[model samples]
Target chain A: MTPKVSRFLRDAAPATPCLVVDVDRVAENYGRLKAAMPLARIYYAVKANPAAPILGRLVDMQSCFDAASLEEVRLCLDAGARPEDISFGNTVKKESAIQAAYAAGVRMFAFDSEPELRKLARSAPGAKVYCRILVGNVGAEWPLSKKFGCEVEMARDLMVMARDLGLDPYGISFHVGSQQTRTAAYEAAIARVAMLFTDLKDAGINLRMANLGGGYPVRYRAEVPEIDAFGAAIMGAMVEHFGNALPEILIEPGRFIVGDAGVLSAEVVLVSRKEQDDPVRWVYLDIGRFGGLAETEGEAIKYAFRTPHDGGAEGPVTIAGPTCDSTDTLYEKSNYRLPLALDCGDRVELLSTGAYVTTYASQGFNGFAPLAEHYI
Target chain B: MTPKVSRFLRDAAPATPCLVVDVDRVAENYGRLKAAMPLARIYYAVKANPAAPILGRLVDMQSCFDAASLEEVRLCLDAGARPEDISFGNTVKKESAIQAAYAAGVRMFAFDSEPELRKLARSAPGAKVYCRILVGNVGAEWPLSKKFGCEVEMARDLMVMARDLGLDPYGISFHVGSQQTRTAAYEAAIARVAMLFTDLKDAGINLRMANLGGGYPVRYRAEVPEIDAFGAAIMGAMVEHFGNALPEILIEPGRFIVGDAGVLSAEVVLVSRKEQDDPVRWVYLDIGRFGGLAETEGEAIKYAFRTPHDGGAEGPVTIAGPTCDSTDTLYEKSNYRLPLALDCGDRVELLSTGAYVTTYASQGFNGFAPLAEHYI
Candidate 1:
């Protein structure tokens, strides 16, 4: 945990099952990322954690935003962001959302299909549009594959169609997937985008931007390559493919900017075993999958935990949330182990949970209050 | 869809991506369950969908409630349910919640571990307590295994310990699983509970209740055993084991009581394909896994769809929610097919979604509003 967050927990002692975020850590992460890639403009993906404090800090950093919905665009605006600094990033958007966002003075938008392109043409007239192309999600824990971006041929035609339909064909975008590990994945995706840029140029549409859609990794029970490595790989590929005439580069990072900035403090509600001699104890926490640990589904995004009994002898454990549903069990097959001294009512902190935790909480599943959040 | 909901939709034309529940269908389902199991008391599982309209109607039907949290206990009370008729059924609970529920005059509680049982004994003095036993969840589409319940021997000992702690050792409870498809699953669980009942009786605890927890099926995309068949199998097993000395049989049903009573109406946001020659279309809906169809995780609950052009030519489709996260993709490997004519802005209905949909909605992921709800 960050010293600021730990200090807050020691003094405030908030109620069980709450998220405590160190705001300064967010600024530090942003600074480090900027140092890693000096030329690339950062667009903070607001869908990760749209808390006002975090957004306000990013606004002070002069960072632009990538909004997944119109409401997110308004959140950026509400946080003192200029309208020109936001992009409507999701390809699948309602026409009304497009109209509202356009009316709000956000000019940049994303589209992968002809229908979405048409919606943008009708609602967001004269807006800058980017075509997303499909890419392989190699070595990603959470792959963002076929649910999104279209094929290269379709994207090539769409950018040309965008120019003909009174829109600015501004860029090409691709994501190697969320929680992407290997830096080579980004290089491969960039090569694909470069090929698309060449094809679109031949089709009479010279796309001037390259959006390296975010898949940056965070430390979560495993070692990942440093951000400097990704920065080096991206710059190397740009020179190799674009002959030093690199397009205006944009990076939409969410997890890397704020993942390690927060910790989820939850209490052990109960500790039990199925049998007297069973080796694995089921550690039930007040916070669960429905309680905002939604990323723990599939036991992917494994989170490192801190307990009061750290450094003590530990045993095999099946961690679970207090919810009655079997799927609420967080880590059964992931070889999770907990301190044997742990018991009910002991406070435990799930580390590096700043991103994608708060917003995914159910409104009130099983009548448990929505997870409480505190920004330091 | 129920004629009541469909007629309401036709007349009212409520906004898309909302739920339309027929309160009358809840009453009819309650009536059928009561008729099928005349000897047992029905405790509506409030965690399924805690909308006030559904709870108030179930209260008017003289239905008892199984609450998973203390807030749910208050909800039942607000809906006119007597404290004496309600049971706090979740195995994992905080001590403060136990104290509050006991102060609210709730007398029946459930526990599976010594820690939770001790908390209940201290907080809800002299309350009737039941121990949950681990049971196989074979043949269940959504299994409730290895999470909440304890070993049978452990349950027998806990019941004896309850009597020693000055609490009433009331009963034994087990859930076969949610969306249970086989009658034999219930029979197998009952056989386990019957053995525990016999062991507790031998220890002079005189366990008088057999809490056959809810696992009754709701027909989604596939045919499930009739409710009448479940009633026959349960009663037949009770007779075979107890031999005219059947204990107070109590059934806690949630999904079966309400799953088929509501339909989720959502609008198609976008429809596109990865490649020009790819036969499978990706249908993006305004409502998705985070929106409330959380049962779609792992494609466990296959919801049947009703569209405007159901009779048209059908083709394979990959259905997904309109979120940037790839995990929001719902059905890809399940062979989901839709009308070839389906396109953006078309309305579709997901059937048998009344039970668990509303409570599972994320507060607001990606700046989208929580799923809207309506009752008639």
Candidate 2:
């Protein structure tokens, strides 16, 4: 099915199989996040595709980083982020990784247990420790609550221990889960985590800020809860819990700020037929499971496949990536309307793949290069 | 759940996250396949994983290759395979890729469309064509018959055209599907495609083989069909259909021959306490999404987490890969009976990942190194 008309076609557009980022939209997203939580310091989660140019733009927007690894910390630093602006969000602290972060001048760190605290104390003794408490329950849909973060009682113990050991327990943190759709889940977690601050205060440990660990759902597909609503709910919950006594809020939003602004565009080099009830069209494109994992992690990102000109006709096609594996499929059911019949050497754009589009999934299969990023 | 007392003490071994292929077993598998298919030529699907060593081993075993791309053709050549031994199995051909394959002297090609036939006619006019037909109604669970082949009616037309144009339509091919569990599907498809050979001979365009394409299931988990039974059923069906007049038989056995023979091995770098669940041992191993996509596809590859030495008590734990994405999981519900308590810097091994294990779904996220492949 073709689009009624094509308004986006340009003769000079580079070939497909490239990652395109809407610079204006990403910057606007950054500004929106800042405006929503004006008092909160934002850390761009580099764990989502940490493309240098994208990180550079985030740096330009005055965003800090929530880095999960030493390499992520280095990536932000390479993109001109100050080491002091990055928080090592990964709670599992290996001595070398912590040492690398410390060497990179990263001041803030997250600790989920006494063992991690001991590692930090032994290695980067002066690093600012943020007690990562296991905050909310993300039910069976995604049970990320099972990963890292200390329980409330254990968090209180660690906070008390940190204060007693003359270590800086500057903040408290909680990551609800990634790709979170429910704003209520976030609000409840915020209210629950805020209580930990009051408990620590009762124990005479004054915390500086509450790191509401990221999971601001990006508009991957469907009506993603508005970032403003999430920010307001968390901010409202913080005010209701502690009023003026609340610490400065710090939020880490990775996917929300970047996910929808990116598009992976590739050309169909060959269209093969498969045996089915109908002759299924196998549109062979450059991007596959490795390049666009968001597609495989269904519901994480919504995939809309379009040819360069929407003015083409539509069909039911199974988009196969270039990888030879039969499982390497981008979309099982793609219903699209384009300007003309798409044949070999036609480009298709996969929308809303910005945040986690690139950085990690570069498999050099077929000697096909990784998508060279282009900022529009 | 620790495996019962065995020499492979969950930890006191090479490491966890290591792909340890029992070379002897893989060799036995090769021997078994050769024994089972006395008349059929085994075309090892190199697209499963183009590891040079693995290719070399197959070459040593006199296995022909089902090359999907120019690079795979080159890999096979580099592994010491002769040019004539490789079949360019991909039906959708790019001009450059076609030129490369021709230059590399790939003689057997699978053709699906008239346009593809024209390309072959112009580029490599003398090459033998395999009239690729879709296994329509072949009740294989994955029925690839939907994507890469032509309708029987269209295949008949192509065969007539090829003969008229002096092209050698030497055989008919139909891939039931990859990891196919049903033997009846292969039998039915064989019966159908074999009729095409007879039809061609009746028309005086005699062809030699009817390829029952690769769909032989590989053991990912314990629930897969018995290979011996499957091979026997396929042989039985071939005899039942084309018996005395049966030309040559060709089967592309990619996963079955190599899948269980390989294991993706890596080591645990960090272990963290998850919020609500058990300790999520963040085994930051060297392997990633690229090594093999079986884990993501929900294929039944058994994962066994082990270490170098008996360190502590044995228990089941969740294994997370080094990739930053929340979906980067190896075994979702595997019970690794660690002989000792596994901590940071411990190793874990994923068992039976030989086929499509290396570079098939690699995402070099966070700069995690590729799974280092080793041979026994």
Candidate 3:
């Protein structure tokens, strides 16, 4: 076991199936990002974890926030973040939420559609708004897929419309995608943004900022580049494309900052073989899809798991969450392997689960409580 | 618009993105099931909704419950259901949950593995237990796969082991699958149970009950056979296979009991074409997968939608929930069509959504609250 897991097991272990977030790791991650991208302002995405302690740690680091909803904005505000330091990042929002965010002193918001722009005009007039442009999500694990951003032409129209509606078209934003692994994807998305900036300038809309929305990949089972590599690429791209006219760079990093900070200690509920001769062992854990870890959707994102007998002879294993729902199975087709001696009550630590797990947990599905979160 | 939609709009138009359940329809559904299957005991699956009002209505009708957890048992008990009338239906359960259920006077439980059987033997000693046999789920919309049930030989061993552990091996149970459409699936599963019963009897264990676990189909976009057809098929299979020595029949229906009784009123958040010439309109609703309606997993279950302009010329539309998550898109690939005139603020009612929507909702993802549920 790693020292972090050992410390968690010794000092702060809650009941099994609980998320234990190490605040120290979060601070290290924040420091790394800040050191790498001194020119870029970090707006920590609150939707990733929304844990108050994590937010407070970011607040202590003098970090800004990218809030998705009124509740997230409130969470950041409660965590001591100034209103000017937070950006309402979700483009599609309820009118009431926009009003509530505006009322709470938030001035920066993101919008993509005319309807949302209209809603912003009504509720958040003169707010510094950013139009999210659709850049294809080719290399990202969690693709946004036309959900948030609009086409560049539509974005141009929306930017002009924002100005006409009396909202400041302050910047342009685009998500390369969540858990974006390829640095080339950033280069491509930045190129698209650069082209858009030129087009908007020709249209008499001088964008003041460029929000490089979150998609900074974190290492799980696969290797990822250091935060410095990403910062260098982004910085190099801005210099090559904009030269002396570089827009103020802002980033909304969700998974990159918190992903490695959390560890989920889950206990094996049962260990059984389907058939006597079957080689595969099915290890059911106390936590599953509904128990937070919804990111295991389609079993696409493979999390690094640490068992006590990690170096022992390994055998094929199917991991499942402790729920009646069949879709709660975490690894069946993924060729997941674990120690053969692992039995019921054996604890396993899921690494890099700090982001997206707790916030996406369903409320008491099949009588299973949401995954308990504990900050260390 | 359908008459139901018109009535809902005219009489009880709730806030957008709310679940409205018709108690009268629930009663009618219960009556229909009772009328069709007079011999089988109706154990309403609490995991389906677990709404207090729905449970109260079931209690008034003297319906038994198939609780998945201790909380579900408590919900039923709070709804005035007798402990003797409730069965702990989930096979994989926490030891504490089993103890809690036993303490709450629930004697009937289900198990499929030796580990679980051992847990039950310790916590719920002398309780009436059933071994779930793996039945193929070829025709199920939501296939259970291998998440549940054991093979016949392992089940036989587990049954004998249950008796050895001093727990009553009360019965054999198998689920054809959830949302099973083919009547032959039930017939085949019942035949398998019959052979198991004969084998168990030969082993000197007299099984006292046969639980044809819930998979009763409900009308969505497709036509489904009435409850009577399923009842007739089950009865015929039992009679044909077991003759006069039939065990007591029990069914735990979740979706069938509640699916048709609920309607979801979701307002259009936006209607937009990604490309100006694109033919398909993307209709965003205030509700999405996290908002409930997670049954739309894989787009396998298609819900019938009724717009105010239902009879107007229709165009292919992509349905999405009002969340920033890309996976929240409901029907992008399912040939879902809506009225071309459907615009922002236009209300659309999702029919037959009563059973699994409310209880499965995420706590709050992307700042959106859980789908508000109202019973009329």
Candidate 4:
């Protein structure tokens, strides 16, 4: 936990299963990212944590936004972000959303298919549109599947068609994947996008932007390359691929900007064993999958935990959430270990949970209230 | 879709993505279950769908309740269910929740461990408690893992410990699984629990109740055995084990009570292919996993669809929700096929989604509003 969040937890003593975010840490991370990649414009991915405080802080920092839906676009606007500073980033959108965003003066949008392009042409006339191209996600923890982007050849045709349909063929974007650990993934995607930029230029569509979509890594239970390494690797790839004619660079980072800036405080409700002699204890927390530690699905995102008994004698544990459903069980195969002294009513903080915990929570699954959020 | 739901959808064209439930169908389901298992008391599982209308109608039928949390117990009480008619059924619960329910006149609870039993002893004092045991979950679509229950020996010990702590060791309980497809699954679990029932009786605890927890399946893309099969198998096992001195039988049916009583109608947001000639089309809808089709996490619980062009020429397809996250992609490997004529803005209904849909929804992931609900 950041010092501010630690102080808040110590002083305020909020209820269990609540997230406390340090807004100052968010600003610091934003500054560090800006320092690492000065040439690229940052568009805070609002889907990560769209709490008003986070949005207002990013808006005050003059950071742009990447909105996944029309409601998110309005959230940014409500936070005093200019419509031009917000990009409608989702490729699959309702035509009504497109018309609404266009009327709201949001000119920039993203699309990948002919139908979506047609919707854009009809709804948001002459809007600057970026085509999301499919990229390999070999090294990412949460590899985003082929749900959003189109094949490279299809994107090439779509960009050409964009200009024909009277929309500005603004750019090409690709996501290596979310929580991408390997810089080589970004480099590979950048090379593929550069070749596409050349192909589009030869086809008489002068694209002026390249959106390297969000996949920046955050430290959880393991180490990841620093933001400086990603910065250097990305710039090196750009220089190698495009020489001095690099297009305007854009990075839509949801996880990186605020991922490590908050901590989720939960209480241990029960600590027991399935068998009397079983070595491993089952630790049940007050919150669960439905309460929004959703990244724990399949034990994909291994979040580090800090218990009140940290540094004491430890033993292997199988962690689960408080819901009655079996799917709410987390960290069974991952071999989680907690301090031996950890018991019911003891507070534990899950570190680096700032990004995706709040909005991902269910309305009130199993009649448990939604996870609360506090921004200090 | 049921004729009632179909008529409501056509006559009162609500928003694109909303759940329209036929409360009359819920009443009919209650009657059917009563007919199928006349010897067993039906405790309506409120976690499935705790809407006021469903609860009120079930209350009218003189149904008891199996609540997963204190808020659910309160929901039952608010719906005119007496506290004596409700069971705090979750094995894992907070002491505060137990105290709250006890204060609110709840007397029965479930536990699988000594620690939880101790909490009940302290918070609920003389409350009657049931111990849940681990049982194999074969032939279950959503196999509830070994997260909630305990070993037979452990449950036996925990019940004794409950009696020692001044609480009533009322009975034993076990869940075969959710969406359980086979009658044999219940028979196998009954055999396991029956042996323990004899063991506990020899130990001087005359437990009076047996909770066969909910797992009843609903027909989705495939058919399941009729409720009569489960009822017969369960009765046969009980009679074979207990002879002439059968205990009071209780079965919690969540999905069976309401799963087929509702329909979720969503608008197709976009329909496209990764490649121009690709055979599989990716159909995006306004509702997705985060929007409460969470049963599709591992492509389990395959819900049937009703499209406007249902009988038209069909082609292979993958379905996804409107959220921008790749995890929002619902069905990719389930061999889902939709009509070739299905296109953007077309409305489709997912049938048998009455249970576990509304409350499981996120707090508006990706800025899309939560799936609306209407009961007629």
Q: Which stretches of candidate 1 lie over 4 Å from their true place?
A: none
RMSD of each: 1.0, 5.0, 2.1, 0.8
- TM-score for chain A as predicted in candidate 2: 0.87
lDDT for model 4 comes to 0.92
lDDT, candidate 3, A1-376, per-residue tens: 2366568676866788888888888888889998998989999988888888999999999999998778889989999999989999877777888899899999999888888889999999999999888887888888787877888888888888899999999989998889988778777878888888899889999998988888999888989888888889888988888889989999989898999888888998888877667798888899988888888988867899998898999999889988778888998998889998898778889999998888678888887788888887
lDDT: the better of candidates 1 and 2: 1
Model 4 C-alpha lDDT per residue in residues A1-376, reported as the tens digit of each score? 7778888999999998899999999999999999999999999999999989999999999999999999999999999999999999999999999999999999999998999999999999899999999999999998999998999999999999999999999999999988999989899999999999899889998889999999899999999999998999999999999999989999999899899998999999999999999999999999878898998998989999999888999999999999888899879999789999999999999999998888889998999889988999
Q: Is the docking of candidate 3 incorrect, acceptable, medium or high quality?
A: medium
Model 2 lDDT tens row, B1-376: 1132123434345533445555555656778888877778999877666767777888888989888877778889999999999998877667677777888888888888776777777776778889877675354444442446777877877888887776788889887777677887787788887778777777888888777778777654447777678788988888898777767888888777777677555656566554435544434444545444444444234544336555766655555555544455655566545543666665555555776555544454554444555556
Give every collision pair in model 1.
Answer: none
lDDT of 4 at A156: 95
Model 1 Cα lDDT, one tens digit per residue, B1-376: 8889989888988898999999999999999999999999999999999999999999999999999999999999999999999999999999999999999999999999999989988999899999998888888888875998898888988888899999999999999899888888778888888888887778997889999999799998888888887898889999988888899999999998889999999999999888778999999999999999899999999999999999999999999997888899889999999999998999999999998888888988998888999989
Over A159-205, each residue of candidate 2 has an lDDT whose tens digit, in order, gives: 88876666798988887777777666667777767778788889988
> Under CAPRI classification, how is model 1 graded?
high
Off by over 4 Å in 4: none
DockQ scores of the candidates: 0.87, 0.33, 0.64, 0.90
Steric collisions counted per model: 0, 60, 0, 0
Q: What TM-score does candidate 1 get on C-alpha atoms?
A: 0.99
- Per model, kept true contacts as a fraction are 0.88, 0.34, 0.55, 0.89
